[model samples]
Structure formats: C-alpha cells, structure tokens
Target chain A: MSYRAKVPKPTVKRLSLYLRELEHRVEQKQPTISSRQLGDALGLTDAQVRKDLAYFGQFGHPGIGYDVTNLVDRLRKILGTDRTWNTALIGAGNLGRALMAYGGWQQRGFDIVAVFDQNPDLVGQWLENHRIRPMSDLAMLVKERDIRLAMIAVPADRAQEVADRLIAAGVRGILNFAPRRLDVHQAVSISSVDLALSLEQLAFQVSLGLLGSLDEDDD
Target chain B: MSYRAKVPKPTVKRLSLYLRELEHRVEQKQPTISSRQLGDALGLTDAQVRKDLAYFGQFGHPGIGYDVTNLVDRLRKILGTDRTWNTALIGAGNLGRALMAYGGWQQRGFDIVAVFDQNPDLVGQWLENHRIRPMSDLAMLVKERDIRLAMIAVPADRAQEVADRLIAAGVRGILNFAPRRLDVHQAVSISSVDLALSLEQLAFQVSLGLLGSLDEDDD
Candidate 1:
C-alpha cells in the first residue's frame, strides 16, 4: 500500500522538474550528479534542491552525490511514472489532435488509449493509431479500458458538459486544455492549462519594463 | 509607469482565476460578489480569497461586497490585460495553429502579430490573418511591430534553437508550449506548459488510490 506523504504542491512540482532533469542526465550517460549541478541546470539553488529531495528520503552521499541510475529509479517509483497509465482524450479538434501527437506523454509512460469527439464528421476518423470515437462511446470505453484519467480539449462552452460526462463515467483526474474553470467534485483532481493566463503574466512583466534587462548588466 | 508589487506567485495565479470568475459573473448579469460567494465558486476558502485580494488593495467593504465592474477593470489593469500586446508565434504546427485560432487571446488583448516557421512548405501559408513567414524575417518584423513577447510551439529538439533566435531578435518574454526545459538568460521570462508533467502528477495521485474518497467523506 502506498502511504500518502504531506508533500506541498510546490515541492511536488519541483520533484517533477527534478525527474525531468535526471532523465536528461541519464540520456547523457552521467552516472552521478551533485545537487549543485542539478540545481544549476534547472535554475534552482543547491540548498533548495537538497531540501526538496529530503522530503522524499535521503538521497546521494556526502561527497559523491546521487547515483544517477538509482535516483532515477527511485524518483520514477515515487512519482508513479514507472507504471503505464491509460488516458482518454475527449476532443478531436486541433488542440486535441496536437496533444495526441505529442511525443512527450508516451515517452513518459502515459498512453492515450482512446479518443472521443462530439462531431459526427470526426467520428471514425483515425488519429495516430486510435480511431476517433463518438461521445456516446465514452462510458463503455472508459469501463472497458479502465481509464481513470482524461484530457479535456473541447471549446470553453462545452468544457463543463464534457467534464460532467467524464466524472459521471468515473474519471477521477482531468487535464483541461480549454480556457475555462471546471467545477469538479472534491474527489476529482483537475489541472487547467490556461494559455491566456500565461500570456497575461508575461504582459504584466513586459508592461513594467522588467524584461530584457538582465543581459544588459552582463554586457 | 507600472509599479511592480511584491505579491506572491500563488496570489497572482489566484487573481487570474478571480478575474475569470468575475467575467462569468458579468456575463450572467451579476453586479456584486462577496468574498465567500467568489471563494465557493472557485473552490477556495473565503479567508484565502480576501487575503489574496488584499495584496492589491481594498476591493469590497466589510458587508457590501465588491462591485463586479470595478473589480474586473482593476484586475485587467493590474494584470496588464487592459492594453493590447503584440506577440510573435515561432512555430506553425498544430499547436501553434490551435493557439493562433484560440479566441481568448484576442478577447484579452494579445494579438499574434506575426507567425514564423523554418519549414519551407509552410512558410508562405496563411494562418488566421497572419502569413507564416520564414525565421530569417523574425528580426525585421519584431522591430517593425515592436513585438516583445513570443510563443514557442516548436518540437522539443528545436525549441532551444528557436528560443535563442527569439532572444537575439530582442524578444523579452516567451510562453513556450514545447515540453522542454528552456535555458535562457535571467532577463527573459519563459513559462512552459509541459503536458506530461500534469499527467504524471495525476498518475501519482491515482497510484496512491487517493481518488473518489473525498466526496464520500463529505457526504
């Protein structure tokens, strides 16, 4: 049984970043890495990296640093990425198709087992290896494939409708790409990717004339 | 001149959420909103909402609540969405096209002034209203349009190369859709949307069997 740790959300996010950095190190055939080295790569301080890792467990040695292969395995197990997860995609539009074609999800062990769309024109069309199915088939497919996670890419107006259906079909996690706030039940986890929010933050910084000044000091 | 506040990042994110909720309220013809009502709508605590808004300044009186029109205008100005920002898109693939077609950006005052691609086949294609130009013309167009913000939706392998070129062309802020960690100078602000990271976090919760129990307890 997996016991829950009281890991802060920020720490959880940092762990994901660490896992990504470790994957890169593994690709480069680096056998070990110091906290400073890993921190430098991700723009974090060494103390912050060590502190974040300490929340999980003790890792690395006093002088030799962390064993790359062993730490990677540990992180994968901790993050639950060592096992494959079957996911359902709920829209077949441009955003949905782009997500289906994204190589990163499959590379990191999340598989899009089925695709669903509301439009009859898109139904039965092939996307990658999976055929686009209709919304009517969602319940049956979720049960048959044991899909507990879903990705919502429909228009903002339809996002809530699709989410209601997914939750009713027993999906417990949703990654929403539509720029809308979803009122999901407490038991369900929903992460939203608001593209406009990011742009607004950037705009706020630019408005303050805070961008492009770092290189000036260096020069 | 726009003054930067020492607001926490989480507070900034919540402000955006509050802005979205207020927009919906406006659409529904609701004029004023209390902190408790707004908190309940967004799954945040009333106290938390009050504290977050307090970072900016006083919004509502003790009992009367906030005027929706005033709050929305204040948020827009604070977030820099009150003014239009000309932005450049550096990849003309599916993700780029989806973002170009996203109506929320235009509604919130971000205009995709130019589109760029390294692929010759797509260079001359028209997306939305902007023609896809070659990367060689990025500097000239950025200068001509005074574009300081860019969005990168290129493949992971080419993301860094495109980012380097964007920086060299005098772009200061980037909203990267590519699932890769970008290395940039401290002066440039980059926000990344890694789809896999969200999936992995969901998988971790699912693995721990932490789904569907909250509502049961609540009920």
Candidate 2:
C-alpha cells in the first residue's frame, strides 16, 4: 500500500494521461505502440514514458514496444479505476448539476450515488436520476451506499463546512471544486479542481510568453 | 520574462496560493504577515515561502515580514492577474455552462467575453447574456475583443478541433476540460482540467490507504 507513496505525484498524473492515450490507441486498433510513439503523442520524452511505466512493472517488449490493450488494463488497475467507486456529491447548485449531467465520471468508473444540498428548495429536486437530498441525509446515504469518495462543488464560504461533514460521514477521498482550501485530518485524501487557478496559471504563461517550450506537467 | 523559466512550475502554482492567502489576509485587515504564518496557512514551510517570494524580489522585511496588501499586489502583477483577460469559452454543453455560470474566474481577472458552440440549435441561445456564437464568428470575436485565452469544454473527440480553431483565431493560451491530449503550436500554452483524472488519482490514494501522510501537491 505504501507503493503509492513511492510514486511521484507527477508520475501518477502521467499514468492517467498514458492510460487515456492507450485507450485511444485501442480504439484505433493499434495493437502495439513504441515508447517513442506513445511519448510523442503526449508531448513527453520516450525515456520519461519508459521510466514511468517501469515504475509499476516491466512491460516493455524490447524491440516491438508495449501492447496497447494490456497497458491500458494494467494502468487501470494501478490507478484503481478497474472497479467502480460509489461517490457522493455535495451542493446542488449550477456546478453540481453540471457534474451530475457530466457522463465522463461514470464512464471512468466513478459513480455519483447521491447528491446533497443544504438549500431546502433544492432538497427534493432531481438531478439526473438521483434526488437531491438535504445535508442531514448525507451520513445515511454514505453509509448506505458505502461511499468513500465525495465531490464538493459548494460555494467557497461553505466548502470547508461541507468537507467537514463529508469527512464526518466517513468519506475518505474528496475532489473539491470550491476555491477555498479545506483543513482535513491526516487520514483523508483531497484533490482540488480549481478553475480560477488553472486560468491564472495559463495567464501567467501567456503573459510571460512561456509557451510550449517547457516540459509542462499535464495535471 | 525569462525569470518565469527559472521559477519552477510548483513555485508558480504556489504563487497563486500565496496571492489567494494574501488577499484573504488583506480582507482580514492584517497589515503584515511573517513567512511562517503564510506558509502555515498553506501547508508549506517558511523556508519555501521565503524562497518563492524571494524569486521575484525581496518582499520580506528583516523584522516586519511582508506587507499583506503590497505582497498581494505584487503577486497579482507577477501572475498577470492585475489586468483583465478577455477569454472565450468553446462548447456550451453541461460543463461549459457551469464554467460560464461560475463567477470565480471573473474575480480572478479572466472575463469570458464570448461563448461558442458548433451546434446549430444552440448558436443563437444565450448563456449569461452572451449569445452562443458559431465557430465562424470566432476569428472576428478574437480580434474584436482582444481574446488571447480560451477554454475548451467540448467532447474529447472535438477538443482538438476546437483548440485548433481557437489557435487559428489567435488564442495564445487554452484551459482545456477535455480528457484528450491536444496538439497545439509551440507558441501556445495549454492547461487541462480533467475531472475523471482527478477522481482516478484520489481513488488510487484511497485504495492504497495512503491518506494524508504524504506531502500532497495541491494543484
């Protein structure tokens, strides 16, 4: 289990990109792909691609390169995407509704089993198939669905409180979209999808004329 | 401008956090703050805070630390958020709609001047006062509004095509929400916000029971 600690964060991120590329290759009926080809497609070096893959296990075929389908499966298991994860979503606002309508997560094996909102008017509203429940129902649903992962799309002011509730309800992983930072216990895992931060980073790069020359990390 | 090349990517990201923290500090009427206080709030070390701030200039006083408002202004200028950036949003789907409705970007200096979707039915529809334009109007709008940045929230298959159109329309930077990797020109900068990828990363950590012990990078 400590193996994940050994894998660098950037490597973990690149693994997701590699998995996406391999899946694309599979769709194109590409039986195999060389490290150079794989790396080139993702704007990475062949050595980096090889090294990242080698971290998990030895899968290189010496001359022929890696089997695209096999690598896809292995990467899936390594990233823990091979199985379905029942996830809870906090907030029923515009962003939360959009996330519910977003089919990408379900396709990637993360299913939003329940949605919660503090607004009384939105409590019974139906987003996709799940009825938007109030905050009080969060604990019940988390336990009922065995939900360990949660997504927070609440406003910045309410995000921390929502996170605390999710953690109290036994959620171990959180993907936060709010712009505020949350203080969590050491036993929890949280990743943020900060839209403004991403835009700011892009703005910095464009402002300084630092374009694609650098080896950018694609998180 | 070349100083950005010397500033590590992580440092650049940290700068954004520093700005956010400083802005928060300003609102709280805190005139000055030590590097340790700022770093503690952000889960970084005082040494890291000092080093990152030192990269741009000597903002710290020998005893008084840094002036909160002054540091915020400097960080804003350094990150290029001091001025407003007129941006375009391609694809008015669910996720795209969410971004359009999200007000965080505007507060951070990114203004979505135009919204575009290739769908004929949605072409004349309005999203937050800006009518959805077809791809044909992209070039004109880019010139008219001085848009150098764009956000692509289109389907994975259409992401590259939208990016190409944006680049052709003179977009120098892109924040892509698509799961696919885009091939942009060397002079253009691109950042991706992959929701599924973030969930996958969280899943991996939760699966390994690697909760919060590791020094997680907050991107």
Query: Fnat for model 2?
Result: 0.60
lDDT of 1 by residue, B8-96 (tens): 44565466678888999999989899999998877677888888788668467778799988899887877777878889998988898
**Candidate 1: which pairs clash?**
none
lDDT of 2 by residue, A67-152 (tens): 88888887777677888999998988878877777678878888889999999999998988989899998898999999989999
lDDT of 2 at A98: 72
Off by over 4 Å in 1: A1-5, A23-71, A208-219, B1-8, B21-75, B209-219
The TM-scores of all predictions, comma-separated, are 0.81, 0.81
**Candidate 2 backbone clash number:** 0
lDDT of 1: 0.78
Q: Candidate 1: deviation at residue A33, Å?
A: 6.7
**DockQ measured for candidate 1:** 0.32
Q: Look at candidate 2 and tell me the lDDT of residue B218.
A: 37
Model 1 interface CAPRI class: acceptable
